[model samples]
Target: MEYQWNFAPIFAHSDALLVGALGTLRIFVVCLLLGLSLGLLVGLARYSTRRLLTWPAAAFVEFFRNTPVLVQIIWFFFALPILVPFEISPMTAAVLGISLNSAAFSAEIFRGGIQSIEPGQWEAGRAIGMSYAQIMRRIILPQAIRRMLPALTNRGIEIFKMSTLASVVAYVELLHQGRLIASLNFNPIETYTVIAVAFFLFLYPLVRATYVLERRLGRSD
Candidate 1:
């Protein structure tokens, strides 16, 4: 048996597909931004001298890193209302699920980056009579962040690709729309081929940038 390939159905829903792709990009960017901020704090806490700070940060990383993001999405979407005062929507659940999971991994990246900085740099800040926050803000973070730029950018790309999982929550992102279109048109081959091309066009550039960045970073290393 041979399969027919027709893009008429896809073309018919081009507007919806475009909207879905844009939605996917929007949520991916939002979650990555949120994850960046949260991960920075968690990373710092991992380097903290206080047991209280380190313990909680460690637990957070372990829980998110070990658990399946799909489970987290379902839990937040379905079970959160019982434990929290506010009800969570599918979009919110999807964002939180991927964002927090990215944060855990990003935290480790940042922790490694910060640790890569020389200890004397911290001492220099102290010698100048700087507070812990001041030292991190003025001296440590700027340098540490520079060292971690390549890793952080790569993480952003990873998070962007992971946004496909949002489909499970009915968020109407790119992959979700493709799945829906395939089901409706019964043209799985054509539908998924377009999806693959779309993802390739979107992701290949970022992957290239990552390679370029890693090369530049390696030169500095």
Candidate 2:
């Protein structure tokens, strides 16, 4: 197949791409913070002694983890208003949906981190007269987080890439903007090449950071 290459249109709309990039960043940062916070709480809850606490947390993790994120996004964007009584913009809906979905997976990651700690560490903490909460905070969590840092970094990269799904909900993220530009100029190949490059530009640093953290953690161990 012979294809004519035109880089001019992509460059001409660089400003729009920049705006879309900012939006993608905004969604990612907000989602990461909120998701991590919620995930930590859910992870802790999953380990709780109370059935009331643990069951709900387990249910949430199962439901979200088992379902596709795209379905969840569609539900939030379309059915949420009917189920509830509040209005939400598509962008807000998209961000909230992805954040909550990511939280479920992150909770599992946190649980694994907590469980990976040697039982001897817990025994030592208790031997030192520390309460469960104190031991978790002062002894176990620190080491577990250090061990989990690479996994967490990888999750961040995954969430960043997943932000492309925001286009489905009419959130003007990078891929959506690229599509719009292509639609106007009739240049899918050129437009998508630029979009792919932009995605790489954003994600490459995160991949590098993950590798670096993995190495550092390996050395510390």
Candidate 3:
């Protein structure tokens, strides 16, 4: 006997999936913003000559980069609440874990992008009487950003996928909703398949965009 496929039951719970998708988007946006912005600061610190700044930044990058993101999420959700006065919500824990992990990885990307510029570009800016901040803003970052687009896009896609991990802590997301629907309807196969298709639909465009960016940058470079 062959397995019978039915998607009608899953469709009946579309509202749950919509709620899960909203949760996923909420987390993704917050994490991406925090991660990239903080990463810029951390990357600059890592690149600095001052030991005061460099040491802590280096330690942060290493710790977050080396450890598993899942462990970080669990730690924030369970362990940190024990240490702190306030309650740690699932959203807060997920945001902290994903954002920090992304910051560590993105810090390296930003640092590498900044460093790739020729030293003469810095000297030229200094000769023109530009301050360090002015030089970075006017001369360096604009160029580096173009080079970093593909990598950053890839990071964004990674963050999107990482949103699913929130379900581990019972944070509602696409996978979490799918699990609920599956359990209720006894249609794990169809439910999970829909979830997978949803992810592919979300990520495929990003993947294509990365390729396009790479090609355009290649031509411009």
What is the C-alpha RMSD, rounded to one decimal, of candidate 2?
A: 1.7
- Tens digits of lDDT, candidate 2, 147-199: 88877887798789889888898898898899999999999999999989888
TM-score of 2: 0.93
| lDDT tens readout by residue for model 1, 12-108 | 9898789889988898889999988899999999989899999999999999999998899888888897899997877899999999999999999
- Candidates' C-alpha lDDT: 0.88, 0.87, 0.93
Best by lDDT: 3
Cα-lDDT of candidate 2: 0.87
- Alpha-carbon TM-score of each model against the true structure: 0.90, 0.93, 0.95
The reply for model 1, stretches above 4 Å from the true place, is 209-221
What lDDT is reached at residue 221 by model 1? 53
Instruction: Identify the runs in model 2 with alpha carbons over 4 angstroms from their true place.
Output: 217-219
Lowest summed lDDT across 10 adjacent residues in model 2 is found at: 212-221
